[model samples]
Target: MIELNQVSAIQQQTQVFNQVSLKIGYNERVAILGPNGAGKSTLLKLINREIYPVERAGSYLKLFGNETVNLWALRSKIGFVSQDMQEDYTPYTSALDVVTSGFFGSMGTHAHLQPSDDQVALARTLMKQLCMDIDEQRMFQRLSTGQKRRLLLARARVHHPQALILDEPTSGLDMGASLGLLSLMRNFCGEGRAMIITTHHIDEIIPEIDRVILINQGQLIDDGPKNEILTSEKLSDLYQTSLQVSQNDGWYRCWHG
Candidate 1:
């Protein structure tokens, strides 16, 4: 489980978050929603320890029930997929190589050793499951925007980490591909594994998600069951505009009036 205690972040003298606290448990699917510049991305960064929150004296953020662990040890258990893939990926690298590098769980490995056969096989399997059939040998820069996003997701799951944190996983995907990605996430739930996704679109919130965390101006407005907190009234307040929140066959849709 990942827990936060009065977690707040300050960057460049701006308070990205303030006294925020939340808990993510096993089999729990959480959605962090807010308008752009609402500190949604900053909150994810705080959880992964990518950047420390301001005045985080003690017990600000705890991962896997530990307050202290070696940096490398902590990253090994967390899988993160961010929208900014250009910086993390090698433009000329192969799709297979991109996924295999997830085992290293860092930007890029400096070693010259080739990945083992098992590693390569696992990468291919993940790609197939995500509906990514591009040639494994294709250069990373050659794929389209949506294809690149799917490849990054495969990369995150390559090592099979216990927790998956995705930022705008469906940013550039079409309807069919977006649904496929959500299905892939639904499979990740169970056996002490959890997935947290941050998305602005209501349609991207999969039905299997058990929890919803709504943020506005760096503050948590609501955090509870999807059905309970993701309603017309609550959503209206979050966006500060009238919205019609509806559900159809386990999918959510919200519209501005």
Candidate 2:
């Protein structure tokens, strides 16, 4: 449900994307794979409307068939979860409060922002569905990293958005936590929702994600089905290092050749 035509973006005096063109459709599962500092985050920001592509000939961005949309309305259609958002919330905010803040499109609850009863109930229901079993009143900062991530996932889905955009969905977690989170994501996508995830790790490309887009150094490297794009040669070139790729039970992994 996103279209970028020869789009280029600049952030902090650095050109993050150059003539990037791509389309993500509704109910599609795709992964934007790249290394660090590879413009992955910048691309996500552009989709989230947190940044804008530079004006140029034959370059445009469209979300849900429109060039312009209200940010509030957009959030209702696409839920975004990122590590930056996790860090943006106040440390003392309660776990449940963090989830309810999604109604206000905020990082955390403010004194003046009052969520209605139904909104709060939805947030709680989402958390339960995600299998987050922590006390609702616990401080966000006190929760484990996986717990915090799950809370953010709940917050993102509180509005029952049609799509989810996740950046480094499992950045800092042990194997168990990573798998748990990915399983939760797969369940979410099973509900006829689209998911666009940006990740460096090959294992993060869940089996449901059929399309894979590779980006490196602010340029599109490759785009195709996961079976074709995630080969050893392409992944090695994408990371600028020798890598041997293997797949098992619909999961892929890479290691030094």
- Local distance difference test, per candidate? 0.80, 0.92
TM-scores for every candidate against the unseen true structure = 0.91, 0.97
* Candidate 2 lDDT by residue in tens digits, 125-208: 988888885699999999988899999999889888999999999998778889999999889878879999999998999998
Model 1, global lDDT: 0.80
Model 2 misplaced regions, further than 4 Å:
none
Who wins the lDDT comparison?
Answer: 2
- For model 1, residues 118-181, the per-residue Cα lDDT tens digits are 9888888999987886788888889887777778888888767778898888887788777777
Please report, as a residue range, the 10-residue window in candidate 2 with the lowest summed lDDT: 125-134
